[model samples]
Target: MSELSMGDALKLFLQKSRLKGSMQAMQITDIWAELMGKTIARYTDKIQILNRTLFIATSVAPLKNELLFQKEKIIQRVNEALGENLITEIVIR
Candidate 1:
């Protein structure tokens, strides 16, 4: 077997672990502002990932409606940021 670097080993472990979703959620949260802009990120209440679905929570009605229209763009941006097609669906709440 070939040797794996520490970073690669950790990535492998994460890919096979139950914490992957949580980790991905954290990554998204960390980049939320940069990925979606400060205004949107500020209004976003929560972010969660499960079963390849992204859940975005917000109390702002207008923002929610706006998000609904940008679902496809959001998915594309997020997937690009993550360097993988990790999110296949989005739920705006």
Candidate 2:
């Protein structure tokens, strides 16, 4: 087979890491849940994980604001969950 273009590769990744399914993995979801907690998770959704970074989308602007407000803390909490700094950045949009 030929190599995948960036877009194709990303599409395939999204397919495999079905947000709900990906959340099933203890390593990924537990850590995520732990960091954000139930209340925050309800409002925010993990949209993508690319280049070792996490991208989240929030329905509530306040949650987005909170994440921005506690950027460093959130980063640290997420890093702690992953046991290493897998996510270098968190984007809220």
Candidate 3:
């Protein structure tokens, strides 16, 4: 038997389980509302992750503008929440 580093072993487990994407997606969705606050979540029409980017649909134009201005800050908050640099960008529509 051989010893494996914690990071390497976890990576192998995630790869074999095929849960990495789904788990991360779920985590982001669950945290979005909490981090953004109730008012923002109410304005958010929908959200999804694809290809390392977060896609968010806003119900109102003002909300879109607000999010656009805070996009980088929001991304940083999300990465800090997840404890991983998972998202590269946010697409608001």
Report lDDT (CA) for all predictions.
0.95, 0.68, 0.87
The superposed Cα distance between candidate 3 and the true structure at residue 51, in angstroms, equals 1.2
> How do these models rank on lDDT, best leading?
1, 3, 2
In candidate 2, position 7 carries an lDDT of 82
Please state the error at residue 60 of candidate 3 in Å: 0.7
Encode model 3's per-residue lDDT on 1-93: one tens digit a residue: 899999999988986886887877888889888989999988897878777798899879988999999999988988898788888899999
* Candidate 2 lDDT, 4-58, residue by residue in tens: 9998887678557755234423456555666678788777765566666667788
Which window of 10 residues has the lowest lDDT sum in candidate 3? Answer: 15-24
Number of backbone-clashing residue pairs for each candidate, in the order shown: 0, 0, 0
Worst 10 residues of 1 by lDDT: 19-28
lDDT by residue (tens digit), candidate 1, 3-93: 9999999999999999888888999999999999999999999999999999999999999999999999999999999989999999998
- Candidate 2's displacement at residue 20, Å, is 18
Error of 2 at 88 (Å): 1.4
